[model samples]
Target: MHNEPLAYRMRPRTIDEVVGQKDVIGPSTALYKMIKSGHVPSMLLYGDPGIGKTSIAHAIAGTSNLPFIALNATTSGKKDVESVVTEARMTGKVLLFLDEIHRFNKLQQDALLPHVESGSIVLIGATTENPFHDVNPAIRSRCGEIKQLKRLTQDDIIELLEKALSDEKRGLGREKIRITKEQVARIAEGTNGDARKALTMLESIVIASDEEDGEYLVDDAIIEQMIKRVGVFGDKRGSHFFNLLSALQKSVRGSDVNAAMYYLAHLLENGDLTAVTRRLLVMAYEDIGLANPAVGGHVLAACQSADRLGLPEARIPLAQAVAEMCLSEKSNSAYRAIDAATAAINKGQVGDIPAHLRDTHYAGSAELGHGGYKYPHDTPIGSFGGWADQDYLPKELKKAEFYKPVVAGEEKKFAGIYEKLKDFRKK
Candidate 1:
């Protein structure tokens, strides 16, 4: 254990030592109460990487006083689960901490279900991917509340670092190392709320620093050098990615340019140009719609240019599109209208087309009452836009009003024309 990496060695051995994730493991939380009672339920923990999912599991194992065994879904299979189950039978109950549980295939998850159900194995699964979207339902249904561990706050990271720095057994306390509060704070913020990353970086800086008279001093220069080497874990295939997209769209819809740009930056940072472009195009039509009809075309052109350019260059066009959308006259009249029409159809509100609107090109159409279609172009009315007022909708839905236009941008003019047409139809 002394030879292990600082992050691994510093993992909390008891619930009292676990940091952050107050939402799930806080003293007043149901999970905390359960652990204290010594009867732990099978649960799944999910969040971003390095956010104490495994640490929480370790804490649970320590408090539960049950046999603890570990397996990773990526490498462990049905046989590995069976091995655990076999041990569980001998021990009467084993706390099985399955890491990366999202990668467990359906068959593998199903095999573990019965043992979990029988309480022989108190399962605690940890995943970076969202269990709601990635985990098998059989396993999901059997687990208790799917706990979401959040990124540790800067203070939480600082507390963990302080604890590790003072612990002689698992941490680097005995060594005559010197680090300032600001330097430690830099590590906390630079790690992006990852406690493991903070601890590992501190360990690296201490080991790599030059020793003078057996005392290692860490400064801003060394800290910045190490911080620059840390990679931001951009999760393009997880729930965080989708959440960012949703946030971007909603911000644009609310006409908040700054908020929209903020989310766009996150997506760009993640390197998902396709998602950014595609979502922007959808927002143009879905939110801007007839209010600023030209925006749809502009967004499409921008998206096309973005797809061709890709990356760093793509961000320019994407940013321009997002900004334009935020400033545009917002309206969802067309979007809501189409959705309302679709809902009616979905509920069996559809009706047969009137004979005048039915296809008449077929030879037998004349015999089936498919004729009498008035030509609006030729049989024009006086000044009602050179139109013949006729029921285009099916007879059963002739009075159904789906396209309720809004008074916004170009749609405002369209709404006036719509009212005139309705009056004309009455005659």
Candidate 2:
């Protein structure tokens, strides 16, 4: 235990000490109430690493006074599980904290189902992967709501670091460390809300520093030397990456250029040029359609250029495109119109084609009453503009209006033409 990592030694022994994730383990939360009531439900906790999945398990054991045993699924097989089961039987009930539970194969997972259902082993399974996608349904069904732990906030990490510095038993309090709040905050920021990384980095810094007078001094130079680069949250395949994409789009849609650029930088840092480009092109059409039609062309050009240039150099054009999108007149008229038309078809609104619009050039068309089609180009002058009175839609939907053009940007011209056509059709 003395040789254990500072992060391990500083694990929260009670639920109250568990920092962040108030939504899951707050005083009034269901999980908190359940635990306080001495009812420890079998559960699965899924989230990014260093977000207190194991600490929560330890806290559960502390609070409920249950015998706790931890086993990593990657290395432990059926025999290890059987030993835990034997311990549980002898002890009446045991809290088994299984890390990387997703790595358990079918047979290995099957071994836990019976014990979990019987309540002999109060299971607290933890995984970095989304449990729904990775955990077996049998195990999932036996577990209660799978609580998703969130990455600790900057404040949470700071609080944890302060606690570690002051804790003599599990921390560096006896070292008489001298560090500023700002320096601590810098460390917190660099860890990207990962408490384990923050604690590990803090421990490393303390170990490398020399005592000045009676206190071990930490300076900006030391910090910079220790933390080479700040960790960026979200990988290409993680849900966080998609969340960043969503944030980028919403910021652009909301016309907050500053926020948009911030998320864009996050994506660029993640090194997903393809995904960001695809999303930008999509945004141009879906969110800015018809309002500023030329914006789409500009964005397409920018995407092509960015793809050709490739990142570092690519962000220049991409930044321009993002700014253009953020400042452009916003409208979803074309997007809504198409979706409305699609919904009409989905609801069985389609009717037989009008006779005048049916095929008439195939041959023997006059006998079938398909000969009344009038070409708009052939209309006489004064009624020009290639306009002609025609029933293009089937009789059932001759009056159905789907394309309600917004009168803004270049779409105002389209709205004017639409009104004129509607009047002609009425006449």
Candidate 3:
């Protein structure tokens, strides 16, 4: 245990010592109440990486005074599980902690059903994925209660790191390293509220700190060296990922090229090429609209290149698309047009398709008066910008205007013809 990394050695042994996730293991929490009362049923703990799923399992065993047996689903086989079952049977009571329980295939997971159902082994299953989607149905059924641990807050991470700094038994108290609150907060925020990350980062810094003449100093320069390990969370699904994507788009719309590129680089660094491609595609059509319609094609080509090449090399086309998107004249006319049209329909303004606009290809369409489309190509005045006086909108929506272009890029040219058409219709 003394040879263990600071994070592993400092794993919370008692419920009271565990930091954050109060919503899951607080004194008033149901899971806590159950464990304290010696009612240790099978439980599936689910959440992000570095959350307290494993520590909570240890706490459960400590509170119950039950024998603790740890196994990782990633490596433990059916024989290993059977060994645990035998130990539980022999001892009469054991709390079995299975880390990454979702990694257990159906057969391996099914092996524990009998032991867990018999009450000989109290199962504590931990998984980062959603249990319903990953764990076998039988195992998940037995683990009826699922306690979800949330990402640690920045304050929670800071407090845990501070305790590690002072605790001698399992932490760096003997080393006597000094870290400012701002420095601690910097590590905490950079870790995205992951306690293990924050603790490990602190440990790395302390190990690498060097004595200058008499005392060891940990300054911004050293911190920078250690924090190179702190990286963007590369999750494809999560609020954090979407938040970054939203920031990238808004930066483009706001014409902040640097900010847009920064976010683009962050996602790319995290191996989110697929998500970047999809988001850039949406941004091209929704945010750039009529301002630079051709940018839509460029964005598509970038997406294609990203899909074909993947990362580092793919970032070239993605960066090109991002630069163009940020530099191009911006408009949301197409997006607004759809929204306005939808609003009109929702408000009961929808009417039957005009007879002339209805299908005319069927054999009897002409007899049903659905073949009289204006054929604007043959208009007497001209084709483009012609037929200015036509009322093609549904009767109730004839006077409604859904697309109003901003005076930018291609939309500026379209705006001229649109205004003229509107005036002609009014006359």
| Number of the top TM-score candidate | 1
Clashing pairs in 2: none
TM-score for all models, in order of appearance: 0.93, 0.88, 0.70
Off by over 4 Å in 2: 71-91, 100-109, 127-140, 210-215, 225-228, 359-371, 380-384
lDDT of 1 by residue, 308-399 (tens): 99888888988899999999997888889889899989998888888888888879998998888778778665565467767788777777
Off by over 4 Å in 3: 117-119, 178-182, 212-215, 235-263, 272-275, 286-295, 301-376, 379-427
lDDT, candidate 2, 115-151, per-residue tens: 8999998999998877878888888998986999989
Local lDDT at 254 for model 1:
94
Clashing pairs in 1: none
Candidate 3 positional error at 337, Å: 11
* Candidate 1 Cα misplacement greater than 4 A, ranges: 362-364, 379-384
